[model samples]
Target: MPLPTGSSQPVYYVGWDVGGWNCDANPASRDALVVLDDALNLVGTPWRGNLRTTLNEARDSRDLIDRLLGLCRHQAQGAEHVVMAIDTPLALPRALLALARGDAVSALGRSQENPYLYRETERWLFQRGITPLSPIKDMIGSQATKGMHLLARFAPHIAACGQWLSDDRTLTVVEGYPSPAKRSPAFAALRQRVNMPATLETMLHQPTPKQQDIQDAWLCALLAWSLRHAAQSVAWPPDSMPAEEGWIFVPVDSLTPPV
Candidate 1:
């Protein structure tokens, strides 16, 4: 069964504040995940930690992913119509040349400051004035690799899946950057509080420093919800999206100053 378009099924969202194995900032290192229901409520406890630790040995990464899959699948609404938004670089950079539409994961060369080795969506984000981290830099450092692994592991789970991606009524996954999106004026006016739907108590329960990830993850989930129902224009057409290079969904109004 697929996610219901009618009001029968409840829609859910997930935000993942991804990191690397050595990410000492959070207890989860490179894997902080949060889920929210249609009412913008946190579904359950946010998951933190590196699967490579407990699931050590061969297939540790796979096991970690399987565990995550279970979490998503378990929380899935009728037909499992969940939108998981991840704060990470979903694809490797696409080739710069006009015709090299081949998989850029193993493409021509590397870039230092730019995302040419990151993904076409990074360049698009730059054009839109949302500067993103250098996926190439993270690639060497071990961050982007985890995101890519998750993407690869989760691609098959997308309902009515697209070629290497999905954005249908069933299950859709999007790349989101909650930090920059939150910087928009719409979010800047908040006083004495983190700009998230999550509770302050919940934020404090986890490591103080990692609260940012919780916020980011929730924001990503919110972005997915918005993309699905409200401003669908926030995300580009799946056809226009890169086949191998994943697309990042940013709020249309959050992109820049209002005219």
Candidate 2:
């Protein structure tokens, strides 16, 4: 489908979280998107859906990415400067790429090197003109590791989307938190500081398997909005930020799963 066209806006951003049973799954199982205005308020309900297939087939990831891009294009039909933050790694640093090609398990180990590799991979994407954010640096500490179960299944889909997209500058993929702890301090702090509406409570209470994906998507969308308007901090550098990168949106998250 063609991207929607309408009145122009100062900035538009979309955040995404791709869900799957494994990194190598044929099709992504669940996905979420959040659309936001330049102000960064909750502009709309987070767009939640699934790919309707598995990522097992080689073409599965490609098809899923097309659908995802379509969703972003459709949602942000009128805005200028679209930014996306995804919950998967967009690009691998050369070192980790070598390890991934060698023993995947060894690279997946919960070690400083592993996360450094991941961070470097993200920085590499930034240098290449792709806006890639590392949720690990923002949320999880260095020692934390991504669960193999999750990474092995989802990584391929993320990789596929990164490879298929031609303009890395326009397509941003950011690592995001997989799931938030219920009633946790972080959740409360986010709500209190952001003044998130009560409607989001329902999302937190829902029992759906994709709850985490939905919430994270919303958060990514918020970041996208911030990137457009907010100045850079040490934690969030303007040049490294997704908004500075491109027009399309994607959300990524560190592999660290919630305990």
Candidate 3:
């Protein structure tokens, strides 16, 4: 599938399903990646593997960073805006951090703001019927940390509005939760009403573990696309939400896919 022509600078959307730190040893648990163009067409063949090979091949830290950029580029031939959506917790709760510092914090008993388990973003999703997992209480600490590590290396600067901006200001990174996002009204509408690529059907019917990862990556890519193109539909966190806590980007039911 090809993107719509005529735009001088193409925008590439990347969705990455983070795996364990040592994902190379486990094929079923390897990280999955999906790249999409502005029109939502697959950019290249989806990739399932870890960063071991890329890191090993590089001569130094700078070379490693270059190789990582190449991996995200895939087959794209020119400079483009890259928006990577990762399915993992990018930050921990503020209250938990405060407590970790041995501050006198009051208990959050039964309150949705459980510092040890839930971030404000997760609680916000819970109020809207989407349950996001916790890195502290859940078994996803490895993946969560992996995502954050990548963010620190690639786009450590957080914008005032909470967007993760790359050092060069070309790449923008966002957090995503595909489990609840796939069930969102926006996804349902996109699946049933949008003019999607033909490969989408094959992906939809298959339920294998690796396939699920790819599907999740694709959904995350969709969120990235929506955030870039359909801003009105994106569920932007309130200004009150701390930029350091991080925010998950997902479109609401009002999303209208570009023609």
RMSD of each predicted structure: 6.4, 10.6, 5.5
> Over 4 Å off in model 1, which ranges?
1-3, 7-9, 22-29, 51-79, 96-115, 138-141, 157-170, 185-207, 232-241, 257-259
Total clashing residue pairs per candidate?
4, 31, 0
lDDT of 2 at 208: 54
lDDT of 3 by residue, 13-98 (tens): 77888888888778677777777776766675666789656634655333433454467555444356677789999998888898
lDDT of 1: 0.56
Better of 2 and 3 by lDDT: 3
Error of 2 at 5 (Å): 20
TM-score of candidate 1 against the unseen true structure? 0.67
**Ranked by lDDT, top first:** 3, 1, 2
lDDT winner: 3
Model 1, 1-259: lDDT tens per residue?
2445566655666678777766655453456677666665566666665644432432422334335545543432234446677787766655533236643434343353344555666666665667777665544336666666655554444333121332333445667788666755433332123233346546733436656666677667667666655564354634665666667777665665422
Q: Which candidate achieves the best TM-score against the true structure? A: 3
- Clashing pairs for model 3 are none
Q: After superposing candidate 2, which stretches have Cα over 4 Å from the reference?
A: 1-8, 21-29, 51-79, 98-110, 114-197, 204-209, 232-259
